[model samples]
Target: LAQEGQFRQRSSSCHCVPTSLSMAVRGLKAVALAACALAVAGKVQLRHSSHKAADSSLHVGSFVTPLESKHQLRVCNAFANSAAMDVFRGAESLTAETPMPYKSCRDFDAPLKSGDKLEFRLGDASSGTFSVADLPNNDAVLLLVIHRHDSVSGAVSFESHVFAALESAQVAVIDTY
Candidate 1:
């Protein structure tokens, strides 16, 4: 009985749970942490989204046909600091923005057929994203892929806005055929 009375007295002096302000402060901290995490994820998602592109142009056939067996092709690659990727139709020429040459993935979105004898201009050195044409400074290397779909003469073909990207500490030609 004495011990119970003493314990009750001791606990009676401390008649406090967490204060409302303290709880509110903790809730604010939790919300801040959640926001930070979401911001980071959103940034990552944006970068990844850049790497992808949607089909904007219709493949009506090429304005010019491939007269020679080998078509002059080029692709604008930015695979070194940037990942240069584009989906093209009737691709006779490609240009590059960086010096790094990308490994060929015939159809980035889809698969390549037997008729698709796409040319890939690889870097003699650095196996990275490169383009053939260097706009201001000679930096990009272009991949010259051959794409020819036989149709009527008065036809036009081009890939839609089929491109997206993700900036990374390092981005390489992970997939190539």
Candidate 2:
């Protein structure tokens, strides 16, 4: 009788070992499947958000100066009383009295000073120009110059979040194309 009882105990223990291994394998498979599902869901969410951002329009207010007109102004660096050409853009208006309406660079020959405030027009309106004096006052300025071939469907692209951060920190951005 005792031998029969011992044999029954050994048989039950052997059966339990296989059952526990099977349960562990099933648990591992379930965990793997859950991880895969989470990864797929994350990728889908990322794709959706990117598509939405690309389709959205970013409005940068009326501070950008779009150089679409024929009027041009060149910003030159005068070193040792000699001017080296730095940047050139379409000058809209310096003031109410002096409005730049020249068609070519040869026609407009006015020199620019360091602290000169030149008002330029972007799209269809006037925009402000930032200088060294504006920096001392902790004023933030966003300057965007769109080139002919550097636009998407005639619209200039920029990262709005980065500009927002700079605006929040009072750091002026002078973007030139």
Output the number of the TM-score-best candidate: 2
Give the range where candidate 2 is weakest over 10 consecutive residues by summed lDDT: 1-10
Candidate 2, residue 105: the lDDT equals: 17
Predicted structure 1: clash tally: 48
lDDT of 1 by residue, 106-160 (tens): 3232222223432323333212221222111111222222221223331111111
Q: Report how far off residue 59 is in candidate 2 (Å).
A: 27
Model 2, range 61-157, lDDT digits (tens) per residue?
2323433212122321111112211222335333334333322112234333335443333434433232312211111122222122243333222
TM-score (all chains, Cα) for each model: 0.20, 0.21
Candidate 2 wrong stretches, greater than 4 Å: 1-17, 53-177
